[model samples]
Target: MTSVKSSAKAFVSEGALSEIVVKIMDDSVVEFLVGLGFVAVPGKEKETLSLIAPNQEFKVEVFSRLRDEGICFSVGPDWCPAEVFEFLRDQKKLTGFYRKIVWEGTSTPKIIENC
Candidate 1:
């Protein structure tokens, strides 16, 4: 696994409740995923996107910011199963990391100012 220092990619879906993918360019750190919402793994060509694909690391970031209440529902039926969120709050990935959520909500999407 790459050093956390090297884990810099981040992204965000463009539509309302759209997916958020982040790529941390080696060019910068604090500017990568900082306050941008979440970080996602780099796409094949750097910007490629996969719908309903969540970045395990990004979810960890959300947990840190969100209340222990946790997300009331799974990110997506396909990307996230009930078992996942059930373990999200008190459970940590066996790989010693957090799961990222890159899926859209169960509804139509338009745009969000902050997303």
Candidate 2:
């Protein structure tokens, strides 16, 4: 008999925000959030997220609802109304910013730097 190791796959809903718990050594969370129009501002032992959503109403609603939640939401620019990649580039902080680019007939997605 042979023993095989299996791992669970992570999936994110299309056009929706995916929440995740951050680890102490995890620094990529901030970059991921920035791509989704939510910039992570440093806080006391935590991060305060500023969302650039579709409209003021949406921003207010989301911020108010998730203000106390200690979760990082992953979102892509296609699902968001803000040009997060451009914003990061313009701000000269595109060091870790990445974008998912899919090629023709390729089922797998490639993560490329947003420079």
lDDT of 2 by residue, 36-114 (tens): 4554435624244454456534543443232222222223447431243344335654323233232235444332323
Candidate 1 has its poorest 10 consecutive residues by lDDT at 65-74
Question: Where's the lowest-lDDT run of ten residues in candidate 2?
Answer: 4-13
**Which regions of candidate 2 fall more than 4 Å away from where they truly are?**
1-83, 93-99, 113-115
> What TM-score would every model get versus the actual structure?
0.24, 0.23
lDDT of 1 by residue, 1-115 (tens): 3121212133222312335332323323323234433333454543432233256565555433321212112234444432343465456542233323333556432221111
lDDT of 1: 0.33
